[model samples]
Target chain A: MHGKRVGQWNGERTYLLCVHCHNPHSPRFKPIKPLPPPQRPSEMKR
Target chain B: MSQDPPCTGACSGETAPDPSRRTVVQFLAAGAAVASTGCSLESFFRKSFRELSPAQVRRYIAELEGRYGRKYGKTVTVGTAGPMEGVKFGYGLDLSRCVGCRRCVYACAEENNQSRKNPQIHWIRVLEMDKARGVDVNHSDIYYDAAEVPRPGHFYMPVQCQQCDDPPCVKTCPVGATWKEKDGIVAIDYDWCIGCRCCMAACPTEPGTSTGPSRTSPPPK
Candidate 1:
């Protein structure tokens, strides 16, 4: 399923296989710095 | 008779109120309201993706491309590609092979054109699980910061949209904004979405869907 075409109905777009997004060597997602939580309305300066 | 009592300001004496003037003022007020909300009148009234005709779809796409190009200072193409016939997409992953590196998470984000800042959105989540506890989700940790992956006695599991055969998210959507395509991909109509987040709660694989905050400021010129 890696290199197969999705057919004419979809303008022959190639199906994105697993390897398209993932590296064979390390399939898991990398750790990321989490975004800060949204500030409360009460915390805003007047 | 005595110059109509000196023509009080509250009363229009010998002059009919102009309907055209009233209409213009009303239109100005409506235009201001729409502008202050930061949504164009056309976009506010645009039909859902499924409801749009081919001509309407093309017109909308062109409008979107223009809007996005101006915002990002680059030409942007928004494709409205439909599902292919006889195609049903499925995904499989080998738990033994996954090392929890999280490359897929960022890749998915970049591919989907999700927001990069203010509120970073990730569709995929990798959870670090202890081998001793097996597949217990309660014992898993998504915030694992190991110096290297495969954390000795731990394993990693990545979760994403299952694209379920019978999606509860679609069923729970009050506005019918989300649906499963013929090719098994679950799609959302952003313009039609009410931001109720019913789909988020209906998802069996918790947090499979997330909502982004509305843009509160104009894009930088």
Candidate 2:
């Protein structure tokens, strides 16, 4: 905050960069099937 | 391609457009190959060296260690133990102080040993945001060198990976190529990178970018 403005993603033991996640490591990450967003309580029928 | 002047807007003389499907396929494949080669920078991230077999991971690591030693004139200790998983770096920005001169970008390029041929790759990108909307990055150019201040209400913001505690990119990685280091740096093993462009989609930045190519080196003494 005082000098540098960069931040990284925390993965407990390993650090991640912008490309790390978006670029991926291997088959561990698969194209996920889109699921509907969680239903909002306010939008639910009263 | 180099001979061709950067094509400008509409009305540049066009050739008989042989934009065939084969051409498109070739372009895509070539792009993929280039992406893989560039990703070699992520030596530690990938399980193999340039897509070598798993049996070769150790040999590849040994070679990399040797290179690091020669390149920096020091031994780089990489042990047989796999890197402990799950570490992350936290970062933030106070846009008010950022002058938008892009010093940080150049610094990152140098620190990371990016390709000298292309100076755009690296860990940071600075932006000169408009006075109206301070966060807009798509249109801002840190390359601008006008002799002025605030750009009539301009502000500077130097940015890199935010290293979110819960990173979208981390959750999205397929092979676990990206990892958080104990020091909180989210590093990529360029070799592990697949050029799938998923990380680009997952990044939180206004317009996500993946840098490659190091800055130009100064003349020898």
Candidate 3:
């Protein structure tokens, strides 16, 4: 892979992976839970 | 409280005969012991940034670096650099230009040393919104993890801290631990922050907003 390479196919569109883009071993993003809402200061006791 | 000198072991000299004074001293000693076990005793009662002398601030930062370094098993430097004189910091994203690749998301997390384990913290979160709906963020999908992005008629919007002119987060902090700087950046004093997360809730942007795992089932073809 000199500078650009065709990565795995995904549906209809094709994506180009630049030499600087991602690690070949683990390219997918990890899902994160949204930060939880804050409770009232009084609720902290519970 | 300001008038009283910080309690020391030998501070009970003349007050030794008073029963109430003895009780108060005993209570303070117990509180100190608990705080010392939590973190450095000095840090627990550290003064606000405005109250600290320059030397005190430097020593405080050094102590933080040492403690965090030991915890993470690597040396880390905590900087107290202030913002530029007149420059204000703001973020702008061009929906037309973004491809929803999520490179920015990962880069921010790694750079900030956010936990990659449970309850990860990602400062930037990109949402895939329907172009037909214009800029309706309430309907935007943040958990969209298609194998490829720039999907069909959807537009991308990257959301982070907006640092509003009248930031609700700053107002919501019970203690004055969080504040907006002159340059329009909202900052939290971690040392003083009770971790109440009122600011997190007050922010217009959703918390824990980050690129998430791919859907288990494939999208309908």
Candidate 4:
């Protein structure tokens, strides 16, 4: 609708599939352990 | 007292050029040329992807393949494929099926070869929000940690490049490093990026795009 295609239509293809990115069982993204923050300039050794 | 003073080189038309100064100038000029020869001036003067001709694109791809091959000690192929005619990409997600597991987050990072360490870069961000609020961004939490997904009444929403028809990121880019492609994909030319973070500021979705230190050499063993 309004130049935007909604719901998969015939003669159209998705660049990527949902299963390619999301698993059917657990579609939610898992929590990630963030990397350590960068060191402060004052904390650096000369 | 009435006699004229010695010329002392002041009354002379022009002073003799200093041989040492001339030699230094020549040496500097030669040194600069030599230094620049080692660096690829072709890359510095290379035009943007949209501006490059077919022949130039091929040459650029070859140069990239050679550079990456040398760096990785393996044959590397740099694809120069253009968008397909009459084909545009659209992405959709089913919120009802989403469980809030961040598998896509890691998948995207690995697929894009994002930097893993030092300055860790993730293009997609999954935010946890309360169901009652109904997509209130101010109340959403990106750092939510839970033992099991679909926690109580919380819902997950993953955000990334919207690939807007009129992208604000592209508009705010002072150097035109990022642009919207014909396939409805937003592309960033890393070489043209100046790390000014102007695009980041212009993006409505915070953390839509990420910037970090580029990995130049092979990671430490």
Best by DockQ: 1
Please give the RMSD to the true structure for each candidate, in Å.
Answer: 12.0, 22.3, 13.0, 14.1
> What docking class should model 4 receive?
incorrect
Q: Provide backbone clash counts, one per model.
A: 7, 47, 5, 8
Clashing pairs in 3: A31-B212, A31-B213, A34-B208, A35-B207, A35-B208
Model 2 C-alpha lDDT per residue in residues B1-221, reported as the tens digit of each score: 01222233432585523345445655576567657777543442333334545556667777889999999999797766645566333676667555555556656656655543432344565566778875777767655555544455677676678876666777777877777667566767655667666777888773334533234544434
Residue B98 error for model 4, in Å? 1.4
Interface root mean square deviation per prediction: 7.3, 22.3, 9.4, 6.8
Off by over 4 Å in 1: A1-46, B1-39, B44-82, B213-221
On TM-score, the stronger of 1 and 2 is: 1
Off by over 4 Å in 3: A1-46, B1-39, B42-83, B209-221
After best superposition, candidate 3 residue B163: deviation in angstroms?
Answer: 1.6
Candidate 3 residue-wise lDDT, B2-84, digit = tens? 12335556654655435567568766976777676786645545641247667677878888999999999999999898776
Task: Quote the true-contact fraction of every model.
Answer: 0.00, 0.00, 0.00, 0.00
Candidate 2: true contacts recovered, fraction = 0.00
In model 2, what is the error at residue B196, expressed in angstroms? 1.4
lDDT of 1 by residue, B1-221 (tens): 01112233544664734556555665687688778989887874572123656766788888899999999999899999876677898767778767788887777766766554444456787878889999988888776766667677988898888888899999999999899988888888887788898999989777644665523323434
Comparison by lDDT, 1 against 2, better one: 1
Which candidate would rank higher by lDDT, 1 or 4? 1
